[model samples]
Target: MMTKYKINCLIVFISILFLHSGQKPCFAQKDGDDIVIGKYSIIHSSILDEDRLLYIHLPRDYEDTQLSYPVLYLLYVDIYNYFADATITTEKLGGTGEIPPVIIIGVANTNRYRDLLPAKIRGRNEGGGADNFLRFFEEELIPHIDKFYRTKNFRMLVGPQAGAVFSLYALITKPELFNAVLSENPFMNPENADFLYPRAEQFFKNKESLKNFLYIKCERNERPQNLEFAEKLSKLLESEKPEGFRFKAEFKEPSGYFIPPIPFGEGLRMLFAEHKLPENFHTNSVKDVISYYEALSEEYAFEVDAPSHMLTFEGDKLSQQGKTKEAIELFEFQLSLYPKSLNALMRLGEIYRRMGELQKARQYYKTFLTIRDTDVAMIHNRLNMVERMISSSAACRIEQEIRKNGIQAGLRKYQMMRSDPNNELYFDESEFNAMGYRLMGAGKTDDAIEIFKLNVKLYPESANVYDSLAEAYMNSGDTENAIINYRKSLELNPDNNNAKEMLKKLKKK
Candidate 1:
């Protein structure tokens, strides 16, 4: 997603997080639980002559995969006021794949005025310490975060209110550091206005292009001074914004602080709007898709693949036209690129099942179930259906054993099939997980718990298995056991917000 930063040059303001709690926070923790979203970390800064607190939120797959991600630096953390908003937004966007997953580093302010507010009027000498803060960002803090955590070169810096002015200042002074600057409602005085055009002239006047994004939005509610500044800055960017320097001003919608946190999501979306696959890019030809993404990679300076949906959409069209073989080819190509892509896996499974290739269909379905990586709720039952045709297969055979005798007898048959060297039966973690859920749905909590326990034993490293066990335990009213399994799930996958919430709820009991 290539979002041009929304730099609202004068509609400046500070925000508080208790905004979401629907009441004033007497203290920080909600419901006696500590911070819900991200954790607290400290970095001692020599340039700022103090220790800085940082709120860091990692993507869900960070611990699971060796993939590096872009960083979103949210300024004025001030104990997670904007930090929570930013993390929540990114998590949703990332989950839906509207935007790629990113590591969010919310730099909490020890002294908000000293660090964020760069310019000072006649009376204020306390401000204007932004230079040292930028140095800390450039020299000390950025390097520290980079060294300790996995981060891509692509970085975004977000600043709200006074912080926005400082972020815009960073754009002019250290444009090389960030790919985008979302300066939200900056306080632009005459000094800032005077400080802008000439500096833009000096820096961007000679360059062929900047290839950076700057988005600004001015607040409204009878602030004539801010409105005046927004107009002047809009004109300045129009004249001086270098080629490829993406810039946009003014909101098409009313942005009154009904917790106008919508702009936060809006600015992010604008910056990376290009990250999404366009309809024109969707074609039946895999070669065309590759070419499009390759060009996009060159533009973003990062490798971007055709989204699974794009490939699947084209594949679906092929299948609808009775070109099953071609659809299979396209889906195979997609699977090779995105090995864990559920769309590709499920499409192939459906195609293979229709062609009477049940073994291949089962294999793809098994893999998809193991991933269970989806935000969409409707597909869960469909994915676990296992067999589309009623056959005397091993899956049905095991179910017969369970009904005739019990879970132990079913396991005996499964083990016999699994242990044979030339076994026709299929055994998989996903298969067991699905069976467990089916048992749970049938009100067989005991059988479900036993089956889930077997899955935990077979795939001990699988966080999803532990999550299943925890849920089964919870359903059986075993709070102590549920808490135990949920803790293990969370330990394995820190991005398990469900496990975290469940643990919090159970602990309060």
Candidate 2:
């Protein structure tokens, strides 16, 4: 039995092998295209106040078409070319209705710690340089790209780890700089929350209009702090609901970690298709796309291939190029070809849902459930009243129980609940509050605060409530409030480790 970790590593290795082999000529093998892949230099005055070197890989078809494609800007702090193969693969497949094509711009760092850090601080190597570095992008680099290339108005940015910190800053400060951004595995900690939350709040309040797609994929090995930060950022993005602001968060538990690159790659391709030149470069009829996918499935049935996801990958790119109808057709075709494919079915349903075809979406979801009865918890939740009405009374009762007691419990509890409709059910808020404590135990003070707030609202009299909230607040730099809450919590319980520590910390502050 191949474990999930082994599969993830195998995929990563194969992807690297694929890139170096270059059997696929989607990367810059052609000439006379401004979307070239090479190093360029710019004077960095604003953030670093020094000269900066960067690399960019332009799309293959960029030169031939007068239209401009959105650029995916990346900061290669430590890792390099993680997505180069997938980027090219997506673009090549997109050209032939397999994925979307977009320019890849890689920004190399002479002093990554300095350029990507949000603050001007000491202790780190060549610290206190981010301001000058960002200045370089605004004053010199972006201007250079616009002048040199026939680019689209849209842009995207990708960063991992330290670079992800910078990406978060860009999202908040320069909200309009990129139409989409990806921040993977940011090394979040105590310091990040102190900075990020205030900035996020300010960003949401000030930047009233933000039409961008933000994708955050936290690795399974990612620090708990980073995971907390990602969760917080995701919730904030969802809550704001800015115009055209779309967001996705993939937890990618150890078993699912390797799957993130697929979505990340797919997202870029989709954004590329949205801004691709001539728009109709990869458009096709529904019949044609269905046939193509059917053939693909036949070719890769025995292998652990991503054939089902491939069509969605293609649809994303097409959608990017303003061929939404074609994109929808392809998604629908993918479902028709592999009615049981979870990825294909979900994508089809999503397309319909986005288009406001709720009935059609529900039908696809129903079909999907018929194929795979397990792991349909979220899909079942998304169904509208009409679609839910089709379920048998017993099924409806089960679903209601599931909604009330979560899918797992509902699975087992359904038998008992079915036998006695009058059985009393109570959701233990203390257990829910304990979940927040567990997060805090893992050093996720910021995320724990969110959970604590909910816990307090639900169980205001719980002695643990004030302690957790005060500790979380103190950790996040709200000293005055921490003091207030510490007193309140201590009033409830004279003995509490959290409240005592928090009070001591606040008093020192």
Candidate 3:
């Protein structure tokens, strides 16, 4: 809820934060327990000669990935309602993937009159220091954030009432400071109204065009003067809109509600209308997406690289189109940009596995495991399947060599490789048993027998290898060899019930 104080009693904190950016934010500090949604960061401003408190909230995945984000400078953080609403609203907007995720910098107010008011009144607590405050953001706070944090050039400004007034002042005074402005319920006093219009006229006359965004909303129970200002400003902006400047104004009083909304979510959305992808955007090729973001960067006046999820989805589209090479390229490029992004990692692993690049698939899947252990079972299953594929590949190669040269030559080579314990192809009884069963399933009884025999050489002391060899022999109808191996298996482990039963059956046969 907004305070019902008169304009002269206006003690406001301008809190502005939105989503999406990619440049660099300056370094700052953290202390005290006022860390709510974000921590209380202190930026010592030389311009104001005071320690300014900034509450900074970064993207959810900022710590995990290498992607930079846009800056959303929020005012009115001390006003819990505005700060809470903006936080929730921006999250919802970013969730839609329409607008990129932004680093929210909510600046707390020290002096409402000195920072938020542009024109001074007759009282001692009168306004007129808004420029110095803006300088604090431009010279001290913003640079501090940019230097310390990963930020983009597309910054947004937002505030309410006096804070909103300051937002508009920043919009016109320092047109290049922020790319977008969301001003809610800002009413003009006689002094600021006199100053703002003339300042705007001069600025508009001087600058050919300004690429920016403005969304103004006024609710009912607001002063008639506030409604009047909102209407007049809307009409004025309509006629004097600059090239590439976006504008939207909503007067909820006409809708019969004077409720002070926590923050205007729709205002942020309209300002970033193009940030959301179209319905069929995923249907485009990777190059098209790259170009889309490239052009968006150009339009936003910043280097707006496509976010990791965008790249992941685009790469998936490529995979679906039978464009394996393109998918790999896009996913690889995503990894290069984001570095260990789960989306890219998982996509690359799945695609490589599908393409039968077992080693590559294993590489990606293993790396994915290190980043996030949430899907341990699923990832482990993929790794196991990859290992089986690799083992099968080695088995087939050895089989071919046996066919080309001699069984003894292949056996000698296998023995030589097995001497090195670190060989990836080295396996225990379970893998050998699995590999042998795969060959048996393929109706390659001779190959299965040869694989089982290799397993015997690897785990000669283990009963399972001999039991598996016995089954392979029985499958090939070599009753004599089956009986021999089964007897040996039972000798190695007398408690081998399967071996005992198989020996009895073969003896009867």
Candidate 4:
């Protein structure tokens, strides 16, 4: 029989085991039914001279979408899972247009005190590996992540407690590594606080501008020492901040030693405040929204497109308001930005059909078919109705001409018809390019040249058109004209690699 003290210790041990087992695993299990939050990977860090595990949570559509996402690197994930939960929730909100999608990378620690502390104390053995740890992230982990993931240049760092102190150290020491920093109740006692405060002040003194977001929050009922340090640091940053450095500090009622999700969510909202679209935006012109995001892209230093669902909703609202022309234009503009949007194509087709434009409706519906394979029955029925309408209308003559003559002659006839006040025949630049390529493939070099020339006339500023014309001229042995057009193409877009190469070859000849 065991003694009473031994029995009590056994019970405590069993309880601890039960609690730990109840927590979520950091990696996916082999069972097929369980949902995987993230995967586990290892990095061999030469700076730290150790192998470290990385817990990575990618966006849900990461596997399917070609889009890149900003990264959020969180520290001390092994001790607290709340940060991961907060990151995942915030990312979901971002998907709903509250912010921008972000990839979460959780760094598991080998030695918490040694890796987090900035320097060694007089009698401490395990408290001065912070520089090596930061070097590990900078030299090894970041490059590995970038190579394996579709990541944008924007990055954020987040931490709590001692990890938070490390975060601030990285921010002050290597400001260029991350675009944002979130530190929750950083461990700032007198010694480290004195060391860090001056460094931050000196950093700001030298820099003219710092385009980064920094948020530091502390608990209201925290230890007096920690709270005092937070206040001092916050005041220093507020007083000596450089231009373009977005900084915020907050003191909340005590939650726990670990950061609660509420403050984390608030920090994320504050950091990406510009990413959200205005709630009261109401416009019939899509250009207004596009221009708003274009300006925001310049501010954020990343290209951002208007959300597709927002565009669709606004277009539908415009259509319901009897602004069909504006709705059509909005949908067309959406297609121009995102050609893969089947919703825009379908909406345009329906709007044209409602306006009794059978030919235009048929064109959009056919494009929808080309992009997607679903809705076969509805598309075929609509196409048949459009064909019936076209067969009984005067547009039948243009279809007969296209069938009787070649594409070039048909295009010429269409142009002639369009010149008449009664006819509305239309041809786009893509149609001309396609026909030109087809003619070029069939040894009709002169016809191809004329088609490309017509395209250049239609779109004078298009470097692609001039480049195609130059290529046609080269094929036809007209080096002088080819050189002229190639030079024009280079002037329009100096980065046109094909034109540069062809020009070099032609000049060599």
Candidate whose TM-score is highest: 3
Count clashing residue pairs per candidate.
Answer: 19, 16, 31, 0
Which regions in candidate 3 have their CA more than 4 angstroms from the true location?
1-36, 122-124, 205-207, 253-259, 262-264, 282-284, 391-509
> Residues 309-420, candidate 1, lDDT per residue (tens digit)?
5677778888887777788888998887667777788889888755545567778877886776444343455444545422435645665678789999987987787678
- Compared with the true structure, all predictions reach lDDT values of 0.73, 0.60, 0.75, 0.75
Worst 10 residues of 3 by lDDT: 1-10
Residue ranges of candidate 2 with Cα displaced over 4 Å:
1-47, 86-90, 96-100, 120-128, 205-208, 255-263, 269-509
What does candidate 3's lDDT look like per residue over 60-89, in tens digits?
667877778888888887664555556556
Off by over 4 Å in 4: 1-32, 121-124, 256-259, 325-509
CA displacement after TM-score superposition, residue 441 of candidate 1 (Å): 38
Tens digit of per-residue lDDT, candidate 2, span 121-210: 445444345556666777777777788776666667788777777777887778767767777787565665567778887677566666
Model 1: how far residue 145 lies from native, Å: 3.1
Q: Is candidate 2 or candidate 3 better by lDDT?
A: 3
For model 1, give the 10-residue run with minimal summed lDDT: 1-10
Task: Write candidate 4's Cα lDDT for 306-403 as tens digits.
Answer: 66556787788888887877899889877765576777988998887655556799999899888665535777788786777566433344334544
Please estimate how well model 1 matches the true structure, expressed as its whole-model Cα lDDT.
0.73
How far off is residue 474 in model 3, in Å?
Answer: 34
